[model samples]
Target: MRKAIIITLVVLISSFVMAQKPLFKVDTLSIELSDLSLHAVLTKPSNIDNPPVALIIAGSGPTDLNGNQPMMQNNSLKYLSDALVENQIATLRFDKRGIGKSVYPAFSEADLTIDRYAKDVRSIIEYLKEKQFANIYVIGHSEGSLIGLIALQDISVEGFVSVAGAGNSADVILKKQLKPKLSAEYFESVEIILDSLKNGHVVKNVPPQLNALFRASVQPYLISWFKYNPAELIKKINAPVLVVQGTKDIQVDDEEAQLLAGACNNCSLAEIENMNHILKTIEGGMQENIQSYSKPSLEINKVLVDTITAFIKNYSK
Candidate 1:
C-alpha cells in the first residue's frame, strides 16, 4: 500500500512539472495610441542574443491579435504565433483600434480608414523602437498589408512581408468579389453603389439587399479605402519586400500577387500550391476549401514557413 501511494505521488509530481513547463512566455502590453489604449502581445524567444522581431498585423474587420474574426470563432493567428515561437522567432500582434480590449468611443467603420490604421502601426513601431530589437519587420496579412505600407511612410522598418495581400483598391476588389456572388440583375445596382462611394458621396439608407456589402458604419471606411491602390503603394516602398500568396486563395488571386511583385523593385514572391487564404492546404471543392478555416488540425504549408524563415534568416545576418 505504501509503494502504491509513493508511485501515485511520483506520477502527480511529474504531471505538475510537465504542466509548469514553459512553451513560450508572452508579454501583454497596453500601448497608448491616439489617446487610446491599444492591447498588444509580444512573444520572445527563450534564449537569444538581440533577436530580430516581426510585428504581425491582422487582416481587415475586427480581427484580434490571435487572428480571430469577430464574427467567427477561428483562432488562426494563435497557431501561427506558436509556430513562429517554435522556429525561435519573436512576434508581436495586436488588436486594432476600437476592437478587442482596445479603448474607443466606437469609431465607425467609415472612420477606420487606412491612414488611421497606419497611425496605429506607427505608434506600435515607436513602442518597439524603444525595446531596441536587432531588426524590425512588419508581417501584414490581407488588409493589414495596406496599413503596413502606409505606416512605412512614417516608420523605418527593416523589411515587410505581405501575406495574401490585395494589389488593387478595396472598391475594385469588392466589386469583383460581389459579381459572382450576386445575381446578374443585381450587378448594375452594386456598380451604382460602388460608383457613389468612389465619387466620395455619402450614401444613406443603403438598399436592404446591399446591407451585407455596405454597413452603415463601414461606408466611410470603404470610401477612403477605395482611393488607394496597393500595387502603386508597393512600388513606392523602398525596403525589401516579400509577397506570399496561396494558389488556392479565392479572395485574392495569383494575378494580384504577381501585380504586387511586379510593382516592387526589390521583391520576392512565393506561391504555395493548394494553400488557401488562411494558409491551410485545401483539397476538393470550394466548400472543402472554406472548411479548412475551422479545422485547427490543418497546418499552414511548410513551404510558406520555410520561404519566410529563409528570407528573414538571410536578411537578418
Candidate 2:
C-alpha cells in the first residue's frame, strides 16, 4: 500500500495549504500634495476591521512602492506587506513623486529634495489619520528611515521602525560607499565635490567619469539630504523606535543600527545575523548575497516578519 500512503500524504499537504490561505484584499489609493499626486497600495486583512496600519517607506533610488527598481524585480516591500497583512495588520506603501505610477508632469528632478519626500510622508499620514484607522505606524527602509523621522517631528504616530537606515549623515555614507569603487584621483575629486555641496555650493565641473553621480542637476537634492544626521534626528522622536539591522548588510553596517538605538532611549535594536540589505538571509558567499537583490522568488527572512509583527501588535490599541 505504498502508493496509497503517498496519495494520502499529498492530500494532507493540500488540505494544510488550503487551511492557511490568504485573507487579505489590496486596493489602490492616492493623495494630492502641492499639485502632485502620489499613488499607494493598501493591503488590509479581510478578517480584521479598522486594523492598525503600517506605512512602508522604501529606500534610496527610484525604488517603487514594491521596493523594486526598473531592472531589479525583487519584491522586498511587497513580500513584507503580504506578511504583515497575514498577521492582521494593514499596510500602505506608495510611489514617490515622479516614480512608478506616481509620476507627474509638473514634477522635475531638479526640484527634488529630501524634504520633498518627507513632505509626502507627512501628507500621507494626514490622509491616513482622516481615514480613522485604529492606529498608525511608520516603517522606513534605508533612506526612508530618515525621511520618516523628519516627518514624525510634527505629527504623532503610534511608533517608528528603521530597517537598514544609515546612522550617519548622507555625505559620510556616500564617501564610504564610493571609496572602494573609485580610483584615488577620482575619489579625492569626489570628496571636493561633496565638500562644495555640503557647504551649499553646486560644483560646476564634476569629473566626467562621475557625472552620473555628481551631476549639476542632482546637487541640490544631495545638499538637502546631507544636512540631517539619523542619529541626531532619532533623538527628537517622541514615539517608540525599533531599529532592525542585518549583519550581512553591505550598504549599512550593523554598527549603524546601534548608533540609532543608542541615540533614542526608547528605541530597541534587532540585530539579525546572516541577513543582507535586501532583507534576505545569506546561505552562501558574496555572489549569493548579491544575487538576492534580483531574486524575487526567494522569500524574505522570517525573523524580520516576527520581530515587526510583535512590536506593532504590542503597541496596537
Candidate 3:
C-alpha cells in the first residue's frame, strides 16, 4: 500500500509540473522610439519555426497589451493570443507610448499623434523582420484599426485585420455619438470644433461638457486622427484586408466593416453575431456588455478566433 501511494504521488507531481509549463515561448521585449521604450510580449508556438506573426494593436484609450487599462481589467487580447498559438499563429502585443510599462513621462497627450503610433508599429515590424518572421500580419482593434491601417501602408505585410474599427472619420463618429446626448447648441459647437480641426485649425473656445473628449492636451492628437478616413484608407491598402465587426457592439456597428469591405479591392468581412465591442459574446443588455469588459475570465467569442485564424491559414497555405 505504501509503495502504491508513493507511485501515485510521483505521477501526480510529474503531471502538475508538465501542466505548469507554458504552451508557448513568451519574450518580453522592448522597442525604442526616439525617447520612449515601448514594452511588448511576443508569444510563439514552441514547436513551430518561422510561424506567422501578428502585431496586435489595442483599441483606444490607455488599453495595455492585454487589452486592459488601469481601472479596467480584461484578458481579451491575452486570450486571443493563446487562441492564435493553439492555431499555430504567433502574436506580438505591445503597450503603446505613454501606456503601461512603456509610459513616457516627458511626453504629453499632444505628443501622441497618429503618425507617432504608426511609426512605433513600423519599428516593431522591422524588429520582427530582423528576427526572420516570414509571415507578418497586423491586427488592430477599434481605434487600433485605424492605426494599423496607416502603419501597414508603406510596410510589407502579409495581411491586415481591422477588428471593430470605425468606418467614418473621427468627426462623423463623434457627431453620431453626441447627437442624442448633447443639446443643439453644444452639438453645433462640437461640429464647428471638429470642422476647424479637420481643416488644420484648432478651436480654443471649447464647451465645458465636451472638455474631456476635446481637451487642449489631446486636440493635436485628435487633429492628426481626424485626417484619416477609415473607408478611404481601406481603399489604399494593397495587402489583403479582413474587417471584423460584432453585431451587438454598442460603440461600432457592422456598417463600418461593410464600408471597409466595399472600399478595399482585397477585403473579407466577418460580421460576428452576438459579440460586443470588447469581442465577448452578449449575455444580456448593455450592462452585460459593459460587464464583459471587466471579466478577465471570459474568452473572446470563439467565432472571432476561428475567423481570424482561418483567414491567416488560408493565406499561409
Q: Which ten residues in a row have the lowest lDDT in candidate 1?
A: 68-77
lDDT of candidate 1 vs native?
0.83
Segments in model 3 whose C-alpha atoms lie over 4 Å from true places = 1-21
lDDT of 1 at 2: 100
**The CA-based lDDT of model 3 is what?**
0.89
Q: Which scores better on TM-score, 1 or 3?
A: 3
RMSD of each: 3.9, 4.5, 2.5
TM-score of each: 0.90, 0.93, 0.93
Candidate that would win on lDDT:
2
Candidate 2 worst ten-residue window by lDDT: 29-38
lDDT of 2: 0.91
Candidate 1 residue lDDT tens string, 1-317: 99999999999999999878776778999888656889899998775656778889999877888877656545667767777777777889999897888747756655677788888898899888898886888999889898898888656888899999998888888888989988887887888889889888867868898897777777878888888888988887767899999989999999889988888889999999888888777777799887876676777777777777776777884
Indicate the residue-level lDDT of 283 in model 1: 71
| Candidate 1, superposed: residue stretches over 4 Å from native | 1-23, 103-106
